[model samples]
Target: MEIKFNDVNYKTKLTDINITLNNSKINGVYNYNSFLKVLLNPKLIEKGNITIDGKVYNKYDPKVIAVIDKDMPFYTSKVIDEILFYSKIRGYKNNNIKEDINNLLEKFNLDSNILKRIGHSLSETEKYYIKLIANLIYKPKIIIFKDIMSGMDYKNKKIIKKLMEELKEQGVLIILTSSNSNILYELTDEVVIFNKGKVLINGSTNDIYSNIEILLNNNIDVPYFSLLTYKANNEKGAHLFYRKDVRDVIKDVYKSVS
Candidate 1:
């Protein structure tokens, strides 16, 4: 369940890049969607190689990697049709697709009536969830999300976070890219920050986010929690632990004051 990029070069778009990603953790690739393109199509790599579990990714395998991106095309008009089409192609030959789709819709808290509506007519959040279900129906080993948290509300983001945890528990490799640093800090276990087709930092999310100066130097926005923790510790002499939730930091602040 590990994917590696060994000195991968894609024309001038991506320079000599080396990354190792695996299951049991959400991997965040900062401000880069082109990496997703290369993984989806390894032939784009002019030099070096991309591998899954030590094997080169020379061919596309829908069962191996599935992407939930806005750019993913929808051929069918109806939501059900779109899901069913991908399901069939991904090899749901003899399985009860109706039951499966129902379960997926329910799992994501999607309404059953939406299945009959036109795919293009749904809201962005709804469409995203539908795409998620379509991809997850096949149980792909890896899932890549491109700019998924950008426009999402807090509730939908929470849903996605919970879903990611569930996927991690099922041993799926989750690679996500987002402009939002807060989302990345809250959701990802590991992050690889890229700058000008090269990796700036690749480490545990907590470790990377703990350094406010590095993030500021790279022009990446520091997550609020991280920034608050840093300011409290350094500026106010209030020793505080870095936490994903603001409330946890508040509790620490209370403890410090008391």
Candidate 2:
């Protein structure tokens, strides 16, 4: 899923330019279906093309859909049912899909029995839906996760993070772009800064965080924890990354106070 851009130039007037994406990960919860549609039909990539597994996906091809539920009015049961039906017919295992749907239904306190009547059982049907989605993801060397954590609570965000880690471990080239730098840093190993139709920097998350001046110049805000460490370093103090590191530092500070 390596992307190599050669002699690539974009127009200033165009806000969205279609570029070839090699193993690019898209992030967003609502954009799941849209992404899937793009994967299945390459023509949909007119805004941006993706080269996956040696196949060139241009605009108009269906993309991969990473389903994310945000308890929105638009995310109606009917819509979920429809997506499940289509996915099932297309030989997609319905396990994960069904589980996610049921989880959403339970959260909303909706009528779970009604869904069962429509071939969505808590037992077999749920597993089927998950299997269907899993089938869709079979041998996926490149994955695009669109706005995966939008509107997700902390608990749900943790779940998504675990899933992301699993995907990364599976050797899937994951590209996730999000407005939430905290979540992005937590989830992705690499970061690509984009502003006003330009790539400001591409590097590891830690490297990007270390370069606060570059981030500020590009209009990208540093994550809060990174800012905290940066301020401490300015005061000739120790710096750290993970929460545990911060916690350990706090413990040392408490010991000094005592």
Give the top-scoring candidate (TM-score): 1
Per-residue lDDT tens digits for candidate 2, residues 132-231, read: 3332333345555545565556665665566556666665556564667776666766766656645556666667776677776666767776766666
TM-score of each: 0.89, 0.59
Residues 1-258 of candidate 1: C-alpha lDDT, one tens digit per residue: 999999999977789999899997899988676687788888889999998998888988887898888767678899988887887888766367678788878877888999999988998788888888888887889998887887788888878888899989999999988878887888899999887788888889999998777777778878988888888888899888988877898799889999
| Index of the highest-lDDT prediction | 1
What lDDT does each candidate get? 0.86, 0.49
Candidate 1, pairs of clashing residues = none
Cα lDDT for residue 22, candidate 1: 91
Q: Tell me the number of clashing residue pairs for each predicted model.
A: 0, 49
In candidate 1, residue 227 scores what lDDT? 85
Query: What does the lDDT read for residue 82 in candidate 1?
Result: 87
By summed lDDT, which 10 consecutive residues of candidate 1 come out lowest?
91-100
